[model samples]
Target: MTYDTVAETDPAVARALEGERERQNGTLSMIASENHVSEAVMEAQSSELTNNYAEGYPGSRYYGGCRYADEVEQLAIDRAKELWGADHVNVQPHSGSQANMGVYLAVLDPGDKILSLDLTHGGHLSHGHPANFAGQVYDVEQYEVDPETGYLDYEGLRETAEEFDPDVVVSGYSAYPREVDFERIQAAADAVDAYHLADIAHITGLVAAGVHESPVGVADFVTGSTHKTIRAGRGGIIMTSDEYADAIDKAVFPGTQGGPAMHNVAGKAVGFGEALQPEFTEYAEQTVANAKALGERLRSHGLELVSGGTDNHLVLVDLRSSHPDTTGKDVEEALEEAGIVLNANTVPGETRSAFNPSGIRAGTPALTARGFGENACREVADLIVDVIDDPDDEAVVAAVGERVTELTDEYTLYE
Candidate 1:
């Protein structure tokens, strides 16, 4: 992270860094799981915390000079616990995938069965993709979204859980548009005497900001990212019920990772602090407003939304019905060309490949935070629909791209 002496001779890196800043200023970042951290958080992340290893938690570190490190780590933990109302918080786990991995490691043996959401039907790769460790190390059973409604099949989940009798029942997703029925999932898990792990990585900010239901009180274990909707640094976080405290901490510390990233933890502390502020609540609310507005506008333009529209920060744009033969890859690349960035995602019953999916996933949290209101979100979605439905139209493309540049100018990133 050091560029202190690079400016003296390494002009190339400096130019590249400025180019990155320019990209942020111009491009519309619609990636659901991405956000730009604040200057305070960035400053803390690049601070002296990086200079120290501080292996081990708090005062029990192997390093001698870890008093301040302990302070920083504990500050993150306390603030996270307060924000999420959890019994225990581990600000380790590197990424959301690893956080869930540690949760599985804590309670389940290798080859133990876990009932989770299916990969293409809104589940995360970490939940149980065949290529991921979750699938290789554990017996992964899966549930799916309803084919007709494009929403959760609670009865299907219950039936699947009853049949599988898994050691753990996992709930959460990267593409689901509706609010999760955590209570129903919990009841099903309880019926089968299974533990429940809710991966709230995508909705952490919503939950923390009180826009969505908190999974902390209901799930036995909850895993999330400090980034994404949480809008913190790029790191995974693990929280547990008091009964599983020791096991969860051990799983995260020795079983999964050795040393914690103190710098990231410091950034997490700043993020948690920001979340505690009243304005962060306003930011979180505006994120949802922008999302709902964008979804409505897109659907009005004849675009099909999986589950109709989103109740949260992200929406998955189903393209097959809207623009025939329009792959998610084309939509993504085309949008990027116009300086609007969003990821290609899989829609329910996606017959296409995962590499180039059938849908585009977009969110408004970052752009909204950048000062795009509901009106701006609606306009952006209208332009997006235009670009996707008619990419070959040069004049339309140019006009939309110009609006994007003008919009960002009024709500600048670094300004």
Candidate 2:
């Protein structure tokens, strides 16, 4: 992790890198869509494969000097297949969004209809948000979680699919904190004769470790980011049946992306190999258990949690009910000052702008990676509640920041 080589050429960038390392070591990262990858994975991502230009699939590359690139790419594909139990896996997409674009290009023509969850209700922008290309290219409609219950309204989703008659129905979410029933979503898609694209970007590790239900066989196309719960290199992956293998490969290669980042593919191979170990299952289980404990403790302090609690690694807290005057951004900044890092996220039935939303999203993936268990998560929750109660109180923030430093030191990382 030393930056001596970089320092020789660019001392400023090296200083920033060292500062980042220190920041991570000092802070608690509760961001749901993030995790700590192993140093082995990091090494692989910084390998010589970064210089390769393998334009096509293994055994049929469009460039020469790709022997090692071919080996690394095939290993990533094989390990991803083993992890997810897919008939075909594409490790080429630059990101989860690009993977979705690849799927769209494979099946849908311009102006084809898409039915997905509403953004404020825990959906991703790639799932047909107006700001993303998917919304502009396709005719899109959306479903929402039951505002009262804070859960997906399956019947409503089915009804929407029937009425919209979309070419594709997207399942899975970014901020939703429950086990997604891929079968139910698939049934909705089936009812409308629409393809089901399940984007499991946030919970890839949970699904791979069997802690959460997988969408590999249920959904027609599955996409995920490697760097989230999976803790691989920073990249995207697409999984599907062999029926659409050729189309998907072509769409990913010539349609959405060109040459793959083979270095990241190497990282995927290493991280996926690590996930296949028995300890990873325990890690995934602990992540969920920690989240539950965190949410329960937060609720005990009278903070309102969306859905009242969580079944996964993340919990969304609606500040409007308990802390009526507190915006998520206010709490977010206060928590950061206290050395706790998460995000201000929009909640279902949001009454404010996305930038300064009413909810704060927190998760346990990074904390779990740092060896945090239920007891530690509860303590973190207590600290968060303390900050939420008096965000502008300098003394309170300073006290919480000291406790955070102690916790971070107790559960050390990257050492």
**What lDDT score belongs to each candidate, Candidate 1 first?**
0.89, 0.95
**Model 1: residue 200 alpha-carbon error in angstroms:** 0.2
- Which residue pairs come into collision in candidate 1? none
Per-candidate TM-score against the hidden true structure: 0.97, 0.99
1-415: candidate 2 lDDT, tens digit per residue: 8999999999999999999999999999999998989999999999999999999999999999999988888888999999999999999898999999999999999999999999999999999999999999999999999989998999999998888899999998999998899999999999989999999999999999999999999999999999989899889999999999999999999899889999999998999999999999999999999999999999999998989899999999999989999999999999999999999999999999999999999999999999999999999999999999999999999999999999888888886
lDDT of 2: 0.95
lDDT of 1 by residue, 241-340 (tens): 8899889889988999988888988999999999999998999999999999999999998899999999899999889886768899987887887889
- Minimum summed lDDT over a 10-residue window in model 1 is located at 1-10
Model 2 Cα shift for residue 127 (angstroms): 0.5
lDDT of 2 at 167: 97
Residue pairs with clashing backbones, model 2: none
